[model samples]
Target: MGAAEATDVESEYSSLVDFEGPDDPSHPFNWSLPRRVWTTAVVAVLNLIGTAASSIFETGNGQFMKEFGISHEVAVLGTSLFLAGYILGFLTFGPLSERFGRKWPLLCGLAVSSLFDLMPALGHSLPAILIGRFFGGLFGVAPVAVFGGVLSDCWPTAQRGIAMALTVSLVFSGPTWGPVFGGFIMGSSALDWRWNMWVVIIAGLSATALCVVVFPETYPPAILRRKARRLRKKTGDESIRTASDKEGLSLQEITRVYLIRPFWLFTTQPILALLTLYQSFVYGVLFLFYQTYPVAFGTNRGWATSLEYLPLLAIIVGIFVAAIGIVIHNQLYFRHHCHTPDGVFIPESRLPPMIVGGILVPIGMFWFAWTATPAVAWASPICASVVIGAGMYLLFIQGFNYIVDCYTTMANSAMGVNGSMRSIFGTVFPLFATQMVHALGVARTTTILGALSAALVPVPICFWYWGDRIRAWSSAKVATF
Candidate 1:
C-alpha cells in the first residue's frame, strides 16, 4: 500500500491503477469483518445522533409555542428551520466527503454541529434557539448522508443490505426515541426545553470523540492518493498518480458539481426522482405525525403526559421489525436477483421491497387516520403507527440500498441529493401539519395524505420494471472500482 508499491502497480496495470491487487489490505473491502462491523456501528451511531436532533425539538413543541407567544406554525419553524438547515448542510458535506475524504469532513461537521447544538441551550429567546437549531442541523450533514458512503466503503453488496437496514433503522429509531427522552424532560416542571439541547450536545460530543479515536480513512480513492503522494516522495517520481489523483477536479469544478449537479440528477434521473418522491412523501408523513402525536394522545384521548410519549415506541418497534423483515426478504426473494447471469451485482432488485412498501404505506396511513379518534381504542392508532412505521422504514431501507447499488463509488453524491430533497420535504411537512389537521381533522387529514401516497404506487412499480433503462439515461458519473 506504500507509494513505491503503488507506482510499480500503476506501471503493471498500464490502463488504470486500482488497489495493488483484489485483496489489497489498503482497501476497506478487504478489511476483517469485525473491523467492518465496528466501523458500521460507529457510523450508524453518529447518524442516529444527528437525526435525533431533528425530532427531539418537537418534544418541547408545547413550550416553544407558549414561550415565543407564536402560532403553532411559527413555533414549528424552530424544528422546521433546523430541518431546512439539513438541506444546506447535505448539499455541502456529503459531496465534500467525496472530494476531500470522509473522516475529516465528518469530524469537522460533528465539531461544528456540536457547537451549534450548545447554542440553543445557552440562549433564552425563541429566535435565538431557532438560529441555534438551524446551525446545528446545518452542520450535521456529514453524519446524515455520508454514513452511506462510509458503509459502501466497507460492506460488499450482499452484506450491505443488512448493514443498511441497521443504519436506516437507527436513523429513524433514534428520532422516534428522542421524543421519549424529550417528553420525560419536558414533563418535569423543574426542567426546561433547554435540557433537550444539552442532552444532544453531550451525546453529539461523545459520538464525535469516539469517531476521532477510532475512525480510519475509508474512502478508497483518498487512501490510494495518499499512497501515491508517499510513492512520489520515496522514489522521487512525481509522475506516480492514483487514478483519482489524475481525475481530480479543481475547486471551481467541485463547487459546480456540488451546487448544480444534484439538482440536475434530481430533476433528470427517473430512478432517482421516483425514489426521492416516494421516500419524501413517506418522510413528510412521519414528521407530520410528530406534530399530531400530542393531539392524538394528550388532546383527543386525554392520556397522561408519560403515556402520550409512549405511542412513539410503536414506530420504533416497527422500524426494528421492518429491518428484520427486509433482511429476511433480501435473503429469500433477492438471493438470485442480486446477481446477473454472469454474476455481476444487479441493483434494481432493491426496488422490490420498496414496491411492497409503497402498497403498505397507504394502507397503513388510511388505517391510522381513520382509527385515530377517542371513539376508537387507543391501541388501534398505536398499532396503526406500527404499520405506517414499518412501511416507511421499508421504503427507506430499500431506497438507500437502491441508490448505493446504482451509483457505487459516487454513492455519496447521489445520497446527498436524496437526503437533501427528503429533508426539505420533512421541513415543509411540520410547518403545515397542525394547520392541515385543524382544517380537515386528524382522520380526514391523514386519510388525504394516505390517498396521496396511494397515488404514487406506480413509482416503485415502474422502477422495478424499467430501472435499467432509466439508469442508461442517467447523467451520474459512476466510477467502477
Candidate 2:
C-alpha cells in the first residue's frame, strides 16, 4: 500500500515540475520580444569580442616583429595559437553548456578570457604574450561554442534564421574588424601593438560586465533544474526534481557526453562530416586572406599601412548585404516550412541560399586573384571581396542552421565538432599563408584557393536534392519532423 502511494506521488510530482505550460513566462522561448532581441544581440556581441581578439594583433605584426626581434613566421604564432585555443574551448565548453547550462559557463569563460587578455597587453617577453593569447582564445571561444545553443533556446525554428544571420555576420566580421581598429592604432604615432591588446581587453571586460547584468539562463534542462530546486524549497518535498536530476554526473557519463559522443557524431554523420569539411575550407581561406591582404594591398599596390586594412571592409559590406537577403528569404520561404503542425521542417530547406553562396565564392576568388595586381584598379579586387563576403556569410549562416535543425538536441555537440575543425584550419592556414603567396605568387596562390572553393560548389546543391536520403542513413537520433 505504501509503495502504491509513493508511485502516485511521484507521478503527480513529475507533472508539477514541468513548465507550467508551453506559454510559461519563465521559459526563454516565451520571453518578451524586446528581451529576446536584446539577449540575442548581447550574445552576438560576446561572440564578436571573442573572435576579434584572435586577429587584432595581425594589424600590428610589423611593430610586433620589430619590438620582439622575431621572424614573421614566429610573430604569426600569436594569431595561430589563439585559433588553436578555439579548438580546446569548443570541445570543452559545448558539452559543459549541455550539462551545466549556457549562462554560467559563458560568464565564467568571458571573465577568465578577459583576465588573460592582459597577458598580451602587459607581457614583457614573447613567450608571455603568446601564452596569454592562447589562453585568451581558449576561454574566449566559450561564446562561439555555446551561443548557437543559446539562440536555439530562445528562438523558435521559424524565426531563427534572421536572428542567426544577424549574429553570424558579426561573428564572421570580428576578425576583420580587429584589423580595422588595430590599423588606426598601429598607424598612430602615439599608439603601438600593445594598444591593440588593450583594446581587446577593454572590449572583453566590458562585454563580461554587460552579460553579467543582462544575460538570463537559457538552457532548458538547466532552467528546469533551477525551478525544481525552487519548488523543493517551497514545498519541502525532496521528491520535487527534474528528469535531469536523476541522471548521473559520473566520470564515465562526463566522458561519454563530452568526448565520445561528439566524436561519434562527427565520424558517423555524413551530412555533418561533409558540411564541416566544406566550412573548414571556407574558414581557412578567410584567415589566409589576413596574410595575403597585406601582400596584395600594402606590398604590391603600395597602399598606406593605415589604409590597407580598409579594403577588408569590403567583406563586411558583403556580409551586411547577405544578412539582409537571408533575413528576407527566411521570412518568405523558410518560415512556411517551420510552421508545420509537427514543427519538424526539412533541414534541406536551409540549403538553397548556400548553393548561391557556393557559386559566388569561387567567382569572387578568381576575380580577385587576377585583379589584385598593382596595374589593375584597386576597386576591382575590393569589389571581388564583396562577392566573397556575401558568399561566405550565406554558407556560414545556412550551414549552421542546417546542422542545428538536423540534430535538434545534439546541435551543440555537432557545432562543437564543426567549430573544432574550422578552428584547426583557421589556425594552420595562416602559418604558411605568407610563404604560399610568395612562392605561388598572388595570382597562383589565389587561383589555388579559388580552385578549392570551386571544387566544393556542388556541396550545397547535392545536399539540397538528396539530403533527406542522406540524413536517413544516420545512426544518431535525427529530428524526424
Candidate 3:
C-alpha cells in the first residue's frame, strides 16, 4: 500500500508486459484443438468463395458478350482480370498479415470482396462489371495468403497434411463447381449473367459472417504480444518480455524478409526454382483449359447452349476421386514408416501422391486434345476432363504440402511467391489460348501442354531423392525434417 511498494509493483508489471516470443502459449498453435479447427474451417470457406469468384462467370460469358456488345476476348477479360487482381493482392496481404495479425486483415478483405461481388449486379456497363470483378479478386487474395499461414500457425507439421488436403479440396471445389453451378443458374429462364455474381456475393457474405462469429485470433506472436501489453498496462511492471518483442524484426526488416528471401530461395534452390516453373506451367494449363473447354464443347460440338456442357461435371468428380486416392496413399505411407533419417517424423513423407498426379496431367491432356472432335463421341472429351482434373488435384495437393513442409515459419511468403508465379501464368494463358488453339488446333495445343507437363514429372522425383542437398545449398531458410 505504501508508495515505494506501489512503485516496485508497477516496475515488475512493466517488465512482465514487455516479454514476448514464440514460446508464448497465447499463440494460435497453442490454442485448443476445437478453436483451431474452427479457424481453419473459416479460412477454407473464405478460400472457397475467393476461388469460386475466379470462374463463376464462365457460363455467363456468352451472355455478357451479347449483352455488352463486346468481343469474346474482351468479355473473357472479366475472368482474367479477377485472377490478375488476386496476383496484385498477394503482394500486399501476406506482409500485412505478418505485421498486423491475421484476423483483422482477413475480415476486412472478405467484407470488401463480398461488397465488390454485388457491384456487377448493379449495372449493365462492361466497365463497371470488370472493375467490380478486379476489386473482388484483389480482396479475395487475402484468404489465399492467410489460409496457408493459418494452417501453419495452428496445426503442427504432423496434422497439417490432412488439414491441407481438405483446405485445398475446398479451394479447388470452388472453381470446379463454379462453372457447373453457373451453368445451372444460367440455364434457368429466371436468371442471367448477373445471377452468377449474386451467387458469389451470397456465398462470400455467409462465409464472412461465420468467420466473424466463430473464428478467434490464432497467430501466437500477436496474441502473446497483446497479452503482454495488457498485463503491463494493468500491473504497472516492466520486466516481462516476449521473444518476438526482443527479436521481432521491425516492419522494414519484415519487408526485407519477404522480398529478399523468396528470390534467394528461387535462384539458389534448384528444387524450388524448378518446382515454381513446373507448377506455374501446370496452373497456366489449368486456366487455359477453362477457356478451351467452352470452345471445344460449346462451339466445336455445336451444343445448342452453354448449359449442354453441364455433363463436364465429370471433371470435378475426377478431382474428388483423385483426392480420395491421395488420402489413401497418405494413410498407407504413414502406416509403413513415419520418420526420416534425421529423426524428424514428417508427414511430408506422404508426397508420393504427386507422382500419380504428374502422370495423370499429361495423359489427360493428350487424351482430351486428341479426342476433342465432333466426329468423336462427346464422352471422349468428358473422360479426358476427368483424367485432367484428377491429375491436377494430385499435383496441386502435393506441391502445396511440399512448400508448406519446407517453409515452416515462412510458408506464407513462399506461398505468396508461388501464387504470384501461378497468377502470372493464369493471366498470360488466357490471352494466348485462343491463338494457340487457332494455330495448333485443340489437340496439338493440348499435346504441347501435355508434353510440357510430362517433362516436369521427373522434377518431383529429383526432389524426393536430393531435396536435402538442394535445401542445404539454398540460402533460403527451410524447415528440416
Candidate 4:
C-alpha cells in the first residue's frame, strides 16, 4: 500500500513541465509560425514607437530655442536627455526581464513611457520638457532591452536571420522616419511643435495595446513557473517547481547578474568592445547625418522644406534594399550552414556582407562629400546616399547578428550593452554635428568622417578571421562556429 501511494505521488509530480522537451506545445520554440510572426511584428512596432520618441522631438529644436528662449546648445539637450535615459534604461531592463519575465517589464515600460511622452507638450517650461524626455527614454526600455530576447526565445537560430532582418530594418529606419513625419506636424500652420509629442503618444498607445493583446508570455522559465504553480494548486502539493525556480534566485543575485553582466561582458569581451566602438561610431554618424542632410540638400541645394525630406527616402530605400539582399544571401549561402541539428548557426556567416559594407561606407561618404557642390548634378550625390545608407544598415545588421550568435541565451544583455553605447554616441555626436560642418564645411566634414570610416575598415575582416579565436577566449562559453 505504501509503495502504491509513493508511485501515485511520483506520477502526479511528472505532470508539471519545467523545460521544453521534444514536441512540447507550450514551448515558445514549438509555437505556430503565424503566432511567432505576429508576436515579432508587435515587438517591432514597440521598438519603432519607443525609438521614435527619442528623435521626433528633433524638429522641436529650433522651436524650443525660439519659444523657450534657450540657446541652440541648451535646446539640443532635449535630444541628449532623451538618449541619456536610454543609457540608464538599457542597463536595467534586460536584468528586469531576467527576474520578472519579459511580459510585465515590457508592458510597464510602454505605459510609463507613454505617460511621459505627453509631458513635453503639457509642461510649458524647458526644465519640464527635458525632464519628461529623460523619463520617457528611461521608461521606454522595453523595446530595446527586451525585444531581442523575445526574438531569441520564439525563433530558432536558422529563422532568426530573417526575423532579425525585419527587426533591424525597422529599427535603423526609425530615426530617419521620425523627422520625415515630424516635419509635417511641425510644418502645419494650425499647430505647433508640441503636436509632435502627441503623435508619439498615439503611437505608443497603439503599440502598447497591441503588445498586451497580441503578445502572450514569451520567457520559457516564466511559462514553466506558471505551469508549476498551476500544478501545485491542482494537486494539493507545494513541491511543484520549474527549472528556473529550482535555482532559488534571490533578488540580490538577480540584480547582480542582470546588472553587472552587461558591463562585465562589455569590458571583458574583446568582441563586444571592438564591435561596440565601431557600431557606436557608425550610429553616431547616422544621427550626425540628420544635421548634414538638411545642409547638403535644404540650404546648400535650395530645396523646398516640403521636399527636403525626399533625400532621406533614398536612405530608407538603401536600408530596405540591403535587407532584401541579406535575405537573399541567407538563402544562397546560409540555407544549410545557418542551421544545424543541434540548433547552432554559423557566426562568421554574418561577416561577408559586413566586409562589403565596411568598404561601401567610405566610398559613399567620399562620393557624397566631394560632389555635394551645387554645380554638380544632385542625382550624383543623391545616389551616393543610397550607398552610404546601405553600408550603414548592413554594418548594423551584421554587427547585431554576430553578437547575438556569440551569446545566444544572453543575446538580450549583449544588445543592451551594445545599445547603451550606441545611445551614448547618438546623444553626443548630434550635439557637435552642426558645429563640425560649420567649422570644416560640409565637404571637409564628410571627408573627415569618411577617413574615420576607412580607418575602421579592418574591424569586420578581423572579426571574420579571428572571431572564433576571440570567442574561445571569452568567458561567455559560446559554441564553436
The numbered model that scores best in TM-score is 2
TM-scores of the models, in the given order?
0.89, 0.93, 0.86, 0.91
Q: Mind giving the per-residue lDDT tens digits that candidate 3 earns over 182-221?
A: 8778878889989998888888888778778777776766
- Model 2 lDDT tens row, 1-481: 5999988867755644678789999899999999999989988888888888888888888888999899999999999999999988999998888889999999899889989989888988999999998998899999888888888899986677778889999999988888888778877999888999888888888878877877899998899999988878888887787877756678987777677777788878888999999999999999999888888998898878887888999999999999999998988887776535876667898898999999999999999999999999999999999999999999998998888778767777788899999999999998999999999888899999999999999888998898888777673344321
Off by over 4 Å in 2: 1-16, 231-239, 337-344, 475-481
Better of 3 and 4 by TM-score: 4
Clashes of each: 1, 1, 26, 0
Prediction 2 global C-alpha lDDT? 0.87
lDDT of each: 0.81, 0.87, 0.76, 0.83
Task: Residues 1-481, candidate 1: write the lDDT tens digits.
Answer: 9999999866754544469788898899999989999888888888878888888888876777777687877778878888899988988887778778898888888778888877778887767778888988889766876787788789886687778888879977876777888888888888988888888889988878877988888999999888877777888766677677556577788766777767766766677778887788788888888767878898888977656787989998888889999889878888767788898777887887788778888898898888999989989888988888888888888887787677655566677788888989989998889888878888899889989999998887887888887776663333211
After superposition, candidate 4 runs with Cα above 4 Å error: 1-16, 232-236, 250-252, 337-346, 475-481
* lDDT: the better of candidates 1 and 3: 1
Model 2 lDDT, residue 129, Cα: 90
Model 4 gets an lDDT of 0.83
User: Please, what are the lDDT tens digits per residue for candidate 4 over residues 1-481?
Assistant: 5999988866645545666566798989899999999888888878878887777787767777889888877877787788889898998888788777888899889889989977798989778888999999899867778887788889986688889887888878888887777767766778788888888888788777776876799998888888888888898687676656545567776665667777777877888888889999998998888778778877898876545656877787889899999998887887766556897656887899998899999999999999988989989888999999899999999888888778766677778889899989988998998889888888999999999999999999998899778877774443321
Winning candidate number (lDDT) = 2
Measured by C-alpha RMSD in angstroms, how accurate is candidate 3?
5.0
Superposition TM-score, candidate 3 onto the true structure: 0.86
